[model samples]
Target: MYTKELFHSWVPKVLQKIFLFVLAIPLLVGSSIYTANMGDMYSGLGTYAETLTFANYSSTIGMMVGLGVILKIKPRFKSKNIIVFAFISLGLLTLAIGSTQRIDIIVVCSVIMGFIKVFGMIELVVPIMFIVSPKGDRGEFYVVFYPLILGASQLVGFLTANLAYNLNWNAVYLMSAIILFGCALLCIALMHNKWTAKRMPIKGLDWFSIVSFTAACLLLNYILVFAKQQGWFYASMNLRLALAAFIICAALFIYRQRTAAIPFFSLAIFTKRRVLTAIVLFSLMGMFTATSSLQSALTSILQYDARTNATINLAMIPGIILGGFICAMWFKREGSTRSLLFIAFSCFLLNTICLYFLISPVVDIRYFILPTFAKGLGMALVYISGGFYFASSLKPTELMGAYPVVIGIRSFIGTAFFSAVFSWGLYQFQSDSMMELANGMDTMDAWVQARGGGMQLYASVRTQSTLIAVKELFGYTALAGILVLVYILLHPFHHLHRRQLIIRRKRLKGESIDGLRAESFDGKDITATAASVST
Candidate 1:
């Protein structure tokens, strides 16, 4: 039977596929609702911006933990039941997020929602993968898959922004909860409660490793998010203690992973050169993407309210679609990874340059379109290319074990660290600019007196200083992008198609292809140890 038939026999196969796709939408949206409506959440909850950052960090960490354990979790329950439970739990969490005034409660709920949401995502993604690539060719599957995921994310961001703009920020959460609950009902009606795979006993699940890793991540996030406000590491008692706790937790988790009979995830994956290279590339991508946070500050400086800012972000959708199209075409041709990285960084450089020149106190909103589009396109390219690169660097058995580490580094750890650094840099530049501009202002002059005295003059200075600070940050980012692009040009890289051809030739000749398989199919040494199997 086809995978679509697994859903239900009453409907046509095509219709079942469509139905499953529709049900998947709510799961996707609910997973990222907090991030899409970040500005509104800050306003509604009356909390510091760091609180929201912590909430996002918590959710992402939870996602990492979920992905780590999902293999074990899947065998214990039916796909349909997992979907139902995930949706109901996420729906209630959505309500809880909307109902609460306490940031702590919202964060706790976000972490739990993040964990359960993965179960639902897997059920949808696996069937969709079967439909997209029945032959189980990951390259072919990703050509279609990346675009779908990125497109949905951009669309969700735009819609949620509009919802928050039209109603209250809390309304977005309410809408999400309603959709989730509705999906739970649809799952009950449309999907069967039969297990798709044979039942396996759950054993040797290292729950301690998961908890320790999560605690370490949260502690590290707490330090980053609050460092600026608390006066960095040396000045704050809480920050110092958090750092100590983070070290202990991280050490414990690493030790457990190394010594435990069934490690939560294999640490051996990190020993590969290609995997390390992918991590560096992903870190750079994260830093580039984190610059988008400056858009909020820029919009606020331009006196655009939340709604207008959200409207401006809609400009990214077209670029996102275009980027996906490019990736699909690139993968179809089995293009060079170097060429992809070059194009991606070029887009980022262009985005930074555009924003650098466009940061004025008074500028047309239309001026933002090109930069935002470039930003969106760059993001899509990096995300897709990075995932493919990471996957190619590992063996099939190692893929699942390495997934959480790659995702955690790419999505949470790298992004959060850079975001905090950018925030701190912006603050420092703004402070310097403020003092310099203030020193130059002649408050006693007749023109200044005519302009409503000291308060008016101070406001003008602050505005100009903010504009200068933003421009400086963008300029620095552009320089960094240029260096990366040059490195890509100088690097020795082979086309993925060429590598695949070599592998095929080696296989046909009955030669040992183990070395090629060990290192992105690049004909490397095969002496590397295999990844440890998780129990």
Candidate 2:
């Protein structure tokens, strides 16, 4: 009986803070579970590089539609408060799905994870944030609680990722299942909710948007999964898949949204320029940092074993926490977002320097730990600040639409594009280096003439040779970081304009005379509490 509404009614300070900490636990644990599962999820699909790309694509699309489907289905449920109950109820199912690795199982888990995210983490933060302090003290909450919880989550996740890399990939899934179940238990024991939204019945389904969305996602997934094995357009299957998917998506989106009662996506949210920019920036940064392929650099180029690779990432905990802590303080005192971003960029540069010069078989784990921390520091700066950025920019009324779209698009598009770009680069260098080594090899003729068992011997040589050639490919990541830096500096705001905008988002509150958050789509009138935004 005591849930979101009960927590909201009259929970006292000491109890509320305890519940909020408990609320944060599942999220932290969930993130760790997610990162760990991802570390091995695609191991069976392809090479380390290919596996990384496939996992990114699958996870992104699964996440995007998970919310879309939930939004559509939730309004149709008859039970009052079903939104809250429906989300939390799926916990064990998530455990089951995560624990199993069959495509069917993983697919199920991804869908559920996406489904629960809306009412679970996103909304919970709002209440916990508002209740944690007096109505006016937003900046302090961000400075203190936000970083601590986020750092805790990412640290656990970072630890899990490394541990999985060393253990069997299957261990990742099992661990995630255990963690998720534990979180569910903790939720029942400790979480206090303060839900106010009434349940909505699904009047009509957005069949058009749904089809379009599915087709678009499926098409993209096909491209990622089978592209290497089948070859791009040369594979008749790829061409057929692309053609079929694009047509369905194009035709369905136009035919349905103009006519449906509840459209899956509102076209209106993109109208806000600042919000749009923020979305793009957020996506790019995530794509740049989190792709599983980055692990290849640590494992392959650095010539470190899985255990060592995991250890290097473990070192990131302090820096990640430090960066978030610093940014929150910066936001409270100076209210300067640009300064926060500038700090992120500077740390990024230092990280790139670490990679540019230091990647070698001779390089010890100690050498890279600082660099890892520096990179993490950059991530911490942008990430913690970004949460505040979204809360401030969008009113509560528009929250679901604005927050999900920004998070969804940024993650999906950024992941797909970056994975494609980085993999292509890795492939090209890998191909070239192998060819060069093969041409120079003294045993080339004999290797080519070998049969059956001889072919196996040749394969081993090829594997070893290819690993050696990947040195050039490893160097490309540092270059990619440089490219990202250049692009960020080129943004029109560069520094001063961005600084002012961050302050403006926080300062103006309701003064945004344009009714900036007033726009509505999908029938919900979205608005944010000044208190909520400040938090």
Predicted model with the maximum lDDT: 1
What are the RMSDs of all candidates, in order?
A: 5.7, 8.0
Give the RMSD in angstroms, all C-alphas superposed, for model 1.
Answer: 5.7
Model 1 segments beyond 4 Å from truth? 1-5, 492-535
Candidate 2 weakest lDDT stretch, 10 residues? 519-528
lDDT of 1 by residue, 1-535 (tens): 2232456777677888888789877776556345667878887778788888888778878888888888887777777888899999998998988888998898898789888877888778777767776765555566567666666776777778778878888888888889889988888987876767666777667889988998998999899888888888878999999999999999999999999988998999999766777788888888788887776778888888665766666777677778778877776666667788789888888988998888887889999899888877887787777667667667756777887878788878788888888888889999999999888788899999998999999898888888888888888888989898887788654444666778889889998787665234322221122222222
Alpha-carbon lDDT, every model: 0.78, 0.55
TM-score of model 1 relative to the true fold?
A: 0.90
Deviation in Å, model 2, residue 529 alpha carbon: 5.1
Using all chains and alpha carbons, the TM-scores for the candidates as numbered come to: 0.90, 0.74
